[model samples]
Target: MSKAKKSEFRPNDYVVYPAHGVGQIVSIEKQEVAGFELELFVISFEKDKMTLRVPTNRATEIGMRGLSSPDVVSQAMKTLKGKAKVKRAMWSRRAQEYEQKINSGDLIAIAEVVRDLHRSDDQREQSYSERQLYEAALERLTREMAAVAGGDEITAAKQLDEVLLSRAA
Candidate 1:
């Protein structure tokens, strides 16, 4: 079956951003930038405010999509529970790749990075940078999940941890 076209966007619609966490579509507006007329989506989160502008027609192509279905979020949670891959490669290189994946706004890829970098309660220390990246990935992934699951950020974060712990055991 063909998918229906979106005729309008409402406030509080969950939207996935490339690098940041899932945000609510707070408003839509038209503005002139560089002397050209443009339309933009204003999204807001508890942590930050972001504005996303697409050529209006190219929004879908840029991966600016609505929140995933519950089933998709469940699959991402399952992915989070899997084994972590620690490549022997250098940290700087791996960090760059992780950043790219997070910005890609692919839920599964973000989950993988979060799972791989996640440290257990008893695990050894993480470098300052590693901790930073881990937090960023986790936040990005969970924000979308929360929006999909119809819950607040704290609940969503806890749910993600539960899935990881269940699989880790």
Candidate 2:
């Protein structure tokens, strides 16, 4: 294992894999692959019902990171309460941007997607694509929130929804 990744992450830690949301590092495995011995971090995603083994050396390069600190989560919640910035671009372009933000593994960016796509009681319903993107962003944000705050995803999601809905009112 590289010196950098040797102590960067540990088993039982909650990490955010850019494309996979939150997952737990179950263990570190040393295995021979293609005639070379490799050290891997085995991550399990309960929500996705999947397991991912990432080479320890490549974890940082691929944006595998620890959960956001409480301060950062607070900032993201503040972002959720802020005004939504709807762009004048086409849905395809906007969707691409939202996906990029969500995959950036930044809690505040994901929160922005949730804030903008969130529909208020008086607002028109979201289109199918918009709803999909919104749900994706919400899931990513809430999962991180739950991991950081030490509770379940459902409670975390409800707390975020309360923040958004209260702001709308």
Best by TM-score: 2
Candidate 1 lDDT, 1-169, residue by residue in tens: 2342444455667777675657777777788979987776667765775455544445566677778788888788888878898889999999988888888888888888899899887789999988988988898887887777777889998888888777667
Residue 125 miss distance in model 1 (angstroms):
1.3
Candidate 2 residue-wise lDDT, 1-169, digit = tens: 4457478999999999999999999999999999999999999999899999999999998989999999999999999999999999999999999999998989999999999999986899889999999999999999999999999988998899899989999
Q: For each candidate, give its TM-score against the true structure.
A: 0.85, 0.95
Count of clashes, each model: 0, 0
Q: How many backbone clashes does candidate 2 have?
A: 0
Shift in Å, residue 142, candidate 1: 1.7
Give me the overall lDDT of model 1: 0.77
